[model samples]
Target: MRKKRIIKPLMTRLFREPHFEEMTNEDEMDLKKQDISRSYHQNLETFKSIYSIPKNTDIKLREFTVRSLNRRAFIIYIGTMVDIKNIQEGIVEKLIQSQQPSSKIQDIVSYPIEKTASNIGDIIGFINGGITALFVDGDSTCYLFETTKTRGRSIEKSINEVLVKGAKEAFNEKVIDNIALIRKKIKNENLIVESQTITKRSKNDIFLVYQKDLVNNELLQEVKDRLDSIDSDKVLELSILEQYLEERPKSLFPTILYTERPDRAAAFIEEGHVVLLMPNSPSCLVLPATFWALMHSPEDHYMRVPYGNFIRLLRFLAVFVAAFTSAIYIAITNYHVGMIPPDLLMAIAGTRERVPFPSIVEILMMELAFELIREAGLRVPSPIGPTIGIVGALILGQAAVQANIISPIVIIVIAVSGLSSFIIADVSMNFAIRLTRFLFIFSAGFLGIYGASALFIVGLFYLVSLKSFGTPYFAPMTPYNFSAKDLLIRHVPIKEKLRPGYLKPKDMVRQRKG
Candidate 1:
């Protein structure tokens, strides 16, 4: 009926050839796109242009002919990035001696030397990655051979996290070797390893490893999301990634854990946590770390239950002495002299009679000097490191006391505090302890025992409020769970039948009664 209103369609060109301008623009766009050229010469020219082969002497492009078929081909690779022996024996020798010139690339390259990549970007990436690319005259694709040359230390004893009874092996700079070390410890098929390039310039590789069946899906997803959110051009070490992944960058207490031993990393992976590794990093990062976990050591599990509990109790006492000793000294002298025994007070007063500065100033001066000596010892060569500590502490303390700059009691207090810090096995927690000790010292200097007590309460509150990847940092203790027995005390291994309940692991039962 509306055919009466059959007006001619305004834009009725249903089929027509594309305009010359449109076709030309499309062609130009295709040319600008990065893709491998079918022409061998074109591809070669592209590589030379991108890599500046003529000016960059490290890039070696060798052209040759297949002797049997008289076909042309070329191989491009970075000389320093690849092993010369492997290039000669594995690639060059095999290519020259091959009689099947017309065979498929796979057959030509052989197993373990797979061929991959046809795009220009990928080809260049492979070349820079120490892989050799062979471009045949008639083939449209390029063949890549793996010849990466990674230089690192052989498996060595753990340097930082020493253990009395455990494997001596530690992770090295080579990530592949580290993965092998982990796989050797964990032979289960569920140990999943996923890797991705985190930086564009260096193309640094980062690996996330965990148990597939044992890991919590949400925890794994959170880790992956945090990793993906990093948009930096360079991440050289796991420490940098740790900083990026940490929720509270400004907090003195670390939420993530770092360890150099593979056995410890494997143990964390088995506990439904994730482990991260990168090249040039001799340690791995363990996520969702708890206070109790950081305080425990591998040697604890190795010892008998009673002996382990004794060591744990001693460590607890040491932490208290390290953190509160100096603050208590300052507090007692400045605010609570009556709290000290009369004879001891008289001796302390006599010792400080000639000192020129107040208790706070004397304590800070010695603490600052000790920190400087510690830093210098760390920076100096191993041969002289211990010497620096002994000379700097003993000689300097004697000189300070003799000069009447600081009393003898101040030196003893600082030394004891420094020594007690070493009992905490985890370096991160030790650092936190050191920082908290300073805070306590200042608090005591200002308000004596009252100030120290208040600050201690506030610090406890902060610890309880903090979360590491959705898990409470100070769990099992603050939340009043039955699991507090394992917090500061080491129970018999047979009596502990469950994993940490706060983690909400998919598999919670660690063991069963005999």
Candidate 2:
């Protein structure tokens, strides 16, 4: 019979709270130098200790043998992270059924990603990435198989930036699936997708995707240098990386574009823009965003030239209304009242005869109420979101008007301005427009038309000064680049034979006469 040996006193003496001050530099170095042992048993024990295997129910370690080679082997993998079907059919079944003795590792696994891991760090990395590790009893090396099985939502229509015509599918949370979508769109050999590890602790994979031939060497080098300089321990999402990657982090306008649709990202890649793809993020980042790119939508490409131009014009007008309508109304009411027709002036005066507050105060109050309603609608569940907006707007506006707290005309102006803001497709740019609107409103309140006009001119100067990755933010408009066409106007598809000359692409001519 085996004897039970109790060493409670020994255990008490050996295990205790660590004292950091007592540890020497050499001891710290020794701790850091720990590596995988050559013996299979030692390596297995190390993994168990590291993962707390017996305590951790999710980690499964199965011991088996290659009967053909007469060697003992064990498979260590996370049950939830790996594909069970692949492990069963690809590894276990094949190994069990092979009658012929095989000494080569390639005979066992035909996985394109099969790799030999020598150290504990490599083994841990492979296991963490949802790969199964095969540790043989005699050999010092271990084999890794990519059996990752990540669950994600199926491709669905884009909730934001929706279109009546164009690709319906948006990017999901899976990075591999996103890359596959891009590859499917652009099958050219020059479409390069390079994987890079950003964070040391998490070892998050970030992909730099771009066309090798079309991408400018300087811009590519700059991107690489910036990525290389990131010294973060963990980057949880792509947006976090974006903040670090941005040239002017505090700028009001977004220097880089973010897109949820694969078609949009692929189109930008074809235009010589480098896209940064991060794991777990549904959106991809497009570098060096231009003013035109921000305003352009996928629907523009789907429609014919004239129709597209018409839509673009309407969108521009919507932006004008969103940003300047309230400000212009305030300016005209306060200082430029002469500009209004006598009939309209008499009607406005008659409506405001009941209200005691100034025009600016009433307008601001209604705008704030509208913003609150917008927030409440956005925060509620999908089915009830729109319902909340409609009910709240109707009740609140009616009540405020009945109480004479705000003028009916003020409500109309605020509602129209808020509605116009929704026409903007890009979320970041839309937010910028909203912020700029607030500035214009305040300016209009102070000095009427003069304040608003001065602020507008200053904003234009600031925009012209800003650059996105060495490309001017205003681009062809400010610098007067001749080769680039279709600014504020959409030309026929065939007429645009050259790429944007301001971008300085290697091959400018997109189409030749031949």
Candidate 3:
């Protein structure tokens, strides 16, 4: 008996699935690798099989005879994605009504053909991007027509980065419109918008907007290399792509500046900075961001020198108040009560006489409550959000004081800290400040003033050491590069002449020395 005595299991079958699994994967790969056929019938059937036509209702395939040429033709597109009017009027109607027998397909069609593709893979990509593809009998190439339906809200006023003196318009979700907005600001021929496909599977495109004449080639290539190195199958937004491009993902401080204002993006481009734009993201990413950039508002430059500098000073003060108020209170009350005047000390002691918790515990409890109120304010419905925040804080604080769970002085400390944090407009910087506030509070609790001071020094060192795309985080300030002195304050617009020296821009002079 040949094999009846001992039938052993195959190692391949025992370790994995049958060989048919490999064949199935190869078949799927072959579908994508196949070339477009010259025969209209064969191309039609292949697409139908690949897209699973009957099972997939949205993949529309319309077959018809081109009466003018006396040839068979077909158009395929996503039903929901393409414009029905463009398909019916621009393509089908124009193709069938052609009077000249010698007319080419491009000449006969009323709509402009965007591109022609001979590969099945490229043709499918065009169709998937809301484009209509036309194939005729005996023709290997497919004509692509742009029939993508524009679906998004119209441009609206700036909401998050609201400015009283600057442009009221903000970027919408449409990338074309966003590009248009930037173009509207910078009409120079050197303003280049280069597009690249960064992902493998999803094929999402990112537009890099910069002035070719001004942007340093090395810097631009470095940015391009980082973007090209992303191996993700899908990256849907600029926000998600920002994380991929960031060198320090876990750092509390943001290395990129995100802005919804096209004017801001345009200004950065003028300064030889690269601005990244993507679809579905209302904001654009400005790379090689500095600490001052994140802290700045567009309105700072929009206003007069004195007014702008005044607000800047206030904002500067607010940052410290927000980050240090709770920690200072914790340090003084817990470890060094002598720092307070006699009257203030007696008042604080009197307020805490009825309270049962230590200074740190009381401050932490109030801070947690304030954070909860602020978070709830953001998450609740728009109509009732402010109401919930106001009423919730009032009731919670009053009840806590009445119940002797927290001191009135601690409430004042936490309230000042919370209010100061709101003065910071940038969301990322605000979060970093608030989080650092907690760290300082814990440090001060452990070792009083010395701990907070030590933490501050360490943080300063970290900030100075951090780099965004090879540019120092605290550039044009520490390790001093010649800038317009626009870091903490603003000079008159006419006096501000230099592009940031640390950027090492190709053109250092913004406005030639007048």
**Per-prediction TM-score to the true structure, in the order listed:** 0.90, 0.91, 0.94
lDDT of 2 at 234: 90
User: Ranking under TM-score, best-scoring first?
Assistant: 3, 2, 1
Error of 2 at 147 (Å): 1.0
lDDT of 2 by residue, 282-373 (tens): 98999878888899898888898888888999889989899999999899999999999999999998889999998988888888888899
Judged by whole-model lDDT over C-alpha atoms, candidate 3 comes out at: 0.87
lDDT (Cα, tens digit) per residue for candidate 1, span 284-338: 9998898888888877777888778888888889999999999999999999999
**What count of clashes does model 2 give?**
0
Global lDDT of each model?
0.81, 0.81, 0.87
Q: For residues 1-514, could you state the per-residue lDDT of candidate 3 as single tens digits? A: 4221221122222124423233244454545555676877767766766576767898898888887889999999999877898789989998788777754897788899998998777787778778999999988789999999868989999888888898899999989899999999999999999999899778898999999889988889999999999999899998899899999999999999999999999988988899999987899999779999999999999998899999898999999999999999999998999989999999999999988888989988989999999999899899998999999999999999999999888888999899999989998899999999999999999999999999999999999989999999999897799877789988888888999988888989889866
**Backbone clashes in each candidate structure, one number apiece?**
0, 0, 0
Question: Candidate 2: global Cα-lDDT?
Answer: 0.81
> What local lDDT does model 2 show for residue 85?
87
Best by TM-score: 3
What residue runs in model 2 are displaced by over 4 Å at the alpha carbon? 1-35, 96-99, 110-113, 482-484
